[model samples]
Target: CSSTRKVPSTEGKVAFNFIQINDVYEIAPLEGGKTGGMARVAYISKKLKSENPNSFLVMAGDFLSPSVYNSLKVEGQRVRGKQMVEAMNAAGTDIAIFGNHEFDIAENELQQRINEASFTWVSSNAFHKKGNSQQAFAKTDRPVSEPLPPYFFRDIKSVDGMQVRVGFFGIVLPFNKANYVIYTDPLETAERLYNTIKDSCDLVVAITHQSMEDDIRLAERLPNLALIMGGHEHDMRKQLVGNVWILKAHANARTVFITNVVYDRGSKKIEVMPKLLEVSEKIPSDSLTQVVVDKWNRISSENFASIGFDASAIVLEKGEPLDGRESEVRSRSTNLTRLVVKAMEWAAPEADLAIVNSGSIRVDDILTAPVTQYDFLRTLPFGGGLVEVEMKGALLRRILTSGEENRGIGGFLQYSEKISGNRDKGWDINGLPIQDSVSYRVVLTDFLLTGGEANLNYLTETNPLIT
Candidate 1:
């Protein structure tokens, strides 16, 4: 017999794929149904998983609250994240991490959503708090299959018989700490987790909700990481710090990241190929997911109709591409802001002027299609109506000036038609000369009459137009 030995058939590489989405809140298509529906997202996931059996779907976090749907109530209980959990379950999300917005709702509600989810969720640094904790909430109808483990481990054996192991952990950035939970340093927590799971796994993956800068710091501290996935930044980002790789996607499901991992058993090398996919009309919708989405759309419309606004009714078409994104609304005068203030002015036509905080307007994108009543609710979700209050021109000037000076604040002032002048010019009330003692009927939200959210202080209301 020949002395030459036959090479082992199992010396090939194993491939693992990951589908990542972060900061997605809207389950339905945004922008007049042009893009970004959870149905399409589900379709993409199913296609990817079909292509590669070793694929995993993930959301780095922030899907629970902050939508008009989240404000709905069923029998006096908040539907805070009931819809979100259902949609994500249909979307095939295998795992997720907590983003800062996850804390925007009450802790009990947060617990309720977490308890309802079917996927595995982990937050390495988050800890249950003492006193008035989330334990008071009722258990979800379908409890999670397992408690959220700080780290998740998975082993893969390729068709050719090559073996690979991936260990995953999730970390969240600093958040509002609203009597819910405390957090440990992400790097420290990561180090502890790595120590416990390192020897058993071939590679480490970090699914983080921290800033890219913090992720870089984490990379420097823990050099053994193979991949890092991030959220909280609203745009796509990718960077390689040393040998560690970091990847992120755009907010609102407008963009996603798909990473393919190849591990070579012979050379002990790992190759990562990443693709940035746009969530657009090209992606087809899964029938089951589309059905769920349609149901939610009907529910959302009915809920808003109960509040006396026909959510499906088209109000305005495109005059121009209106900027409604949070950054623009919170920071500057945008076309969307101008249009919304115009509506406020129209709503209170009898008043001399109308004023609102920029923060009160919330849909975060440029509208290039039909505007509906649901879009209005997305802009102003807190349910405050217009109130006409009489105040001295001096107090009006003070409120406007206060709002102007405090630019970049959510409560920053945005005025209705014909109201001009700035804090620097002493703000001409109604674009007219101000008389210190003269009374003017100013239309604004009742929230402002109680407190100048932008620091208006109300300055005392003498005459009231209660209608």
Candidate 2:
């Protein structure tokens, strides 16, 4: 707010800056307090708003679930995403799109969060399945068409009073879930919305939470879109496809993308320049917003403390950064998963091996030095007691083979050090071939015992001994 962002003096040109982030889970700084606090983001917002006469703060998706803070009990109930909306409101967010995780919780809870937000919200193909007419859920102020308005528009005038139209639309991954909501074809919906506004708007921008492949396909199909601010993947990426530019930042508010749009009135030309901002100590905290963040942080810490876990205290000095990112851990080996499977083994020391679903490991971040109680909770937010079972070698082989078949899924197995396998090929235990007729003891979560996986349902059916 104090100083203006210096820009080259380009005559007959005016600028607009777009500030964007996605997949934020933590309200406070992560990595042992080294990166990503909402107060810093709030400060940057104020600075960006002052620097550019026209600007927008946007989030693509996945702010509603898979969080350690959500695991905290507030008044003896799940505080799922109540903290996120409060912090985003303090940060002064302008708009947001619905990500797949938004549907992870109950439908009523999501509607409650929507009503709680102070910013405008938009969506693509997100509609209520019932009510006879397939009513759209997102209540937009400026209604465009059926199934909820697909886009929002605003206009700004240059120094000479020439009006410029800026239009925005949003689309997300087509994660189909029955009964409550529906996700129509993403590319088709985006194309239709762009066609409707292309005639009137000078620049059309998109807010999306889809794969880069879909982003590229959408850009190629609709060449009129100026930029696609994307999410879903934690990796930061920037690419130009046809006439459209695509951008994404790291997840958990660790990174952000700021796009400066310069429009020249004389040449009727537009140029887009994007910069990646790493949320670090360089950005000062806005004390007003920091107050709200601290309130939630303090409450969360105390909640964890009551359960014999000091959320902020150091637990272990990690030798290397444990890769627990969603995309990576769900598909491959990670120290966090290994540590978790080992813990399961400790509880059932008599078992031959320990195994659990990758989806069960939801902390979704790298564990650096001085790992804290919060870090462990983040890794296993949905806490449950471990269970042990006895099964024939044939059943064990079948269970592992099924897990390998569904590779890269959250439910994929992450087993203990004693067990190894390629889901598609075969499995081995303790450096020896499994005897078909012999029975082996194994440890796993009760969820798995109660039919969490397709083949795993047999565990409960047989009613094996709970060691």
TM-score of model 1 (CA atoms): 0.77
CA lDDT of every candidate: 0.76, 0.77
Worst 10 residues of 1 by lDDT: 1-10
**TM-score between candidate 2 and the true structure:** 0.83
The local distance difference test score of model 2 is 0.77
Kindly report which residue stretches of model 1 are placed more than 4 angstroms away from their true locations once superposed. Answer: 1-11, 132-146, 326-332, 340-362, 382-467
Cα-based lDDT at residue 313, candidate 2: 86
Top-scoring candidate (lDDT): 2
Candidate 2 lDDT for residue 155: 72
Can you write out model 2's per-residue Cα lDDT over 234-321, one digit (the tens) per residue? 6787999876789998888788899988777677677889999999877788887798889988888999888888987888875888
* Model 2: CA > 4 A from native: 1-12, 75-77, 130-133, 138-148, 176-178, 264-268, 317-331, 348-352, 384-413, 421-425, 433-467
Worst 10 residues of 2 by lDDT: 1-10
Candidate 1's residue-wise lDDT over 348-393, tens digit each? 8788878788756656566765777778777776566888877777
